[model samples]
Target: MKIVATEGCHLIGKNGERWIDGMASWWSACHGYNHPHVREAVTAQLQRMPHVMFGGITHDPAERLASRLAEVAPDDLNHVFFSDSGSVAVEVAMKMAIGHWRRHDRPGRTRFLAFENAYHGDTTGAMSLCDPQRSMHARYSGAITQQFHVPLPRDETTETNLDRVLAEHSDSIAGVFVEPLVQGAGGMRFHDVNTLTRIRDACRRHDLLLIADEIATGFQRTGKMFAVDHTADLPSPVVPDILCLGKALTAGTMSMAVTIARSHVFDSFYSDDPGAALMHGPTFMANPL
Candidate 1:
C-alpha cells in the first residue's frame, strides 16, 4: 500500500483509506506524523531560512534545541555533536570514547566490548557492534573492523565474564557498549535493571567508558526519557560517559542525530594545539532548520 499522506499516527493510503501507524514510522514519529507544532516550527523556520552552514556560525533554533536536549538528557550530557543519522552518531560516539582515552596516553584502548545479538547501527563502526551470527552484515564479517563480543546478560555468569574480559583486556579496551534496558534491534531483548548496574559498575571499576546507544530506545520509549535514566538506582547513579540519540529527536521531522558527552570527555579534547581537537565533524552539524 502506497501512503500519499500522513497525520499523527495514521497514514493516508493511495485509495484515501487511513491506516494506523504500527511501526511509529520506524520508531521515528514518536509524536505521530505531521504534527502541528513541528509543522509550525518548520513553517516559521522556512520564512526565515531553510538552512545555514554550521562550521563557524550559530543560529536560534539550533541553539534552543541543543539547550532543550541537554536539559532533558541524563546528567552532564551537555556537549552535543550533531550528525545526519543514528549510525553516524554511533560512529562519532566511538571516536569520542577512543579519543578520550588516547588524549590521556592510552591509545591502545581502541577496542570495544558489546553483547551477542546486539544491534547498534549499520555504519562500519556501528556494524562492528552488531550481532554477526544471523545479521545482515554477516557477509561483511571479514570486511569491517572486529571488536570483542560476549553473550547477552543472564545471571552471575554474565557479570563474571564481562568483568573477566575487561580485566584481561584492561590495557586495550576503550569502552563497553550497551543498548540499556532494551536492545531494540537485537530482537527486542530486555534485561533486568541490575544488569545495567553491573555494567556501570564494571566500567567504573575498570576505568572504561560506558556508551549507551539510545537511538532506538530514547525519549520516553522505555518509560523514561532515556534508557540510561533507569540506571538511577545504581550505587553511583551517574549517566553513561557518552550517548547517541536520534529518530525521536526533532520528532523525526528532519534527518538529525547527536553524540553527547560529559564534561570530562569534552575536556580531553580541550587544548591549545589545533591537532588535539576532534578531527571529525559533519558539514550539517548545527544547521538552523
Candidate 2:
C-alpha cells in the first residue's frame, strides 16, 4: 500500500486506510510521522535555506549538529562527516578508518573485519562489510570486495577468533566494524555486553581501529543514547574509534547521516601535503538546512 500521509504513530494509505507504524518507518521515524516539532524545525530550515554546497562552505545548522553529536558521542569521536544517507555514511566511515591507517603510513591496511551476523549498509563499500552468511547481496558476491568475517562472538574464544583474523590479515585490515549491541539488518541479533568488550579488547590488543555502525542503534534506540553506551561499564575501558550514525538524525525529518571519528583518526589526515587530506565530500554534505 502507498502511504499518502502520517500522523503520530499511524500512517494513512492512499485508500484512506489507517495503519499503525510498527517499524517506525524502518526505525528512522522515532518521533512518529508528521510530528509538529519535526515539521516546524524543517519548515524553519526550508525558510532559511534548504541546502548549500558543503565544499568551500560551512553552515550554522551543520555546525550546531556536529557540536551536539560530539558532545553526546562516547570516547574521542569529535570529528564529524555529514553525508546524505545511511549507506553513504557507512561508506564514509569505511574510508575514514581505511584512510586513518593509509595516511598514517600503513597504506596497505585496506581490508575490514566484520562478523557473521553483521549488517552495516547497502552501498558497495558498506555491503562489503556486511556479513556474507545470509546477505541480501549474495548474488553480487563475485563482484563485491570480500571482507574478513568472524563468527558471531558467542564465547570467550570470540576474541581468539578475532585475533586469528587480525593475525591472518596482519596489518592489511583497517579495523573491525560491527553494529554494536544489536545488529540491525543482520536479523536484529543481540549479544551479551561482554562480547562487545571482548571485541574492543581484541581491537586494542591488535592495534586495529574499532568502527561501530551505530546507524540503527543510535539516538536512544537501545535504551541508551547509543548502543556503545552499554559498553562503557566494561571491565576494559574502550570506545569505538569511529562511529557511524543515521536514521533519526533530524529525527528522520530529513535525509542525513554522519561518520564520527576520534581526533586521532581525524588527525592522520592532517598533513602539510595536499594529498594527505581526506578528499571525500558529497555536494549535500553539511547543508545548512
Candidate 3:
C-alpha cells in the first residue's frame, strides 16, 4: 500500500492502482491533491523565497496569511502566532493562556480542564490536555503536568459535575480546553451546541479562559469554518479566548499552524517589559512556502 503519487482525490499505489484518498492525507488536503492553483502558488513562492527565519524579519506571505486568517477567524481572534505543526500550535495556545494569567498576576493558573475523551496534540503541553485515561500519552503520566479531565457535559447532571469541578479547581485552572463539536483523535466523538454552550457558560461563570483546539475541525471539516462556529446561534454565543489551527492550514503542502488569540489575551502581553513577550520560537515557523 505504498503511495507513489497523488492526483486529484486519488492516490497511486506502487502497483499503479488508484485508491480514493478517503481521509485526505489525515485531513490536511482540503482541495484534493496536486491542485493546479495550489501548485502554482507553491511554485511561485518557492521561486521567490522558500524559507526565511521569522525572528525580527517578516515576509509578505506570512503577513498576508496572518491578516487573512484574522479576517476569517471567529469573534475578535485577531492576534496570530505561527508554528510548524498542530501539536506545537496547541502548545503555544497553552502557553498563551498560562502566560496571560501569569502576566495578570495569577501564575498559579497553570493547569487546564479538558474532556475525558479529548485529544489536543502530542506535544508535552498539548498531551497533558488530552484524555488522561484513554489518550496515547497515558504512559507518560508521571512525566507531564497533571490536569483535570472531566466527561463531556451532555446532560444536566454532567454539566453540573463540570461546574462542580471548575468551582473546585478554578483557582489553579488556566482554562478549559476542548476540541469543540467533534473530538477528532479522541474517537471522533460528537457533541451538540448545547454541550458547547454549557462549557462556555462554565468558563464564563468561573472567569476562566477557553481554548478551542480546532486543528482537526477547522477549515469547514465540521460544516463550518471552525467547530466553535456551530455555537454561533446561542444567545451569548461561544467564543474561545484562544484558538489553535493546523493540519489543513497548508493544504498538505507544507508544515504550518497558527495560534490565534482574542484581544484581551493578546493585551496581557502588550507591555514594554522585555520579559513579558512569549519566549517560544520555532525556527520553521512562518516558513514562506
The candidate scoring highest on lDDT is 3
Q: Best-fitting candidate, measured by TM-score?
A: 3
Instruction: State the lDDT at 251 in candidate 2.
Output: 75
Candidate 1 stretches greater than 4 Å from native: none
Q: Ranking under lDDT, best-scoring first?
A: 3, 1, 2
lDDT of 2 by residue, 72-123 (tens): 9886789999998889998987888888887778889988989987788888
Tens digit of per-residue lDDT, candidate 1, span 97-121: 8999999999999989998878989
Residue pairs that clash (backbone atoms under 3 angstroms), model 1: none
Candidate 3, superposed: residue stretches over 4 Å from native? none
Q: What lDDT would each prediction earn against the true structure?
A: 0.86, 0.84, 0.91
Tens-digit per-residue lDDT, 1-289, candidate 3: 7899999999999999999998998899999999999999999999999999999999999999999999999889999999999999988988899999998899999899999988888878888988878988888887898899989999999999999999998889999998889888788889898899899889999999998989988999989898888778867888899999999998988889999999999999888997999988999999999
Alpha-carbon error at 29 in model 2, in Å?
0.5
Clashing pairs in 3: none
Which residue segments of model 2 deviate by more than 4 Å?
Answer: none
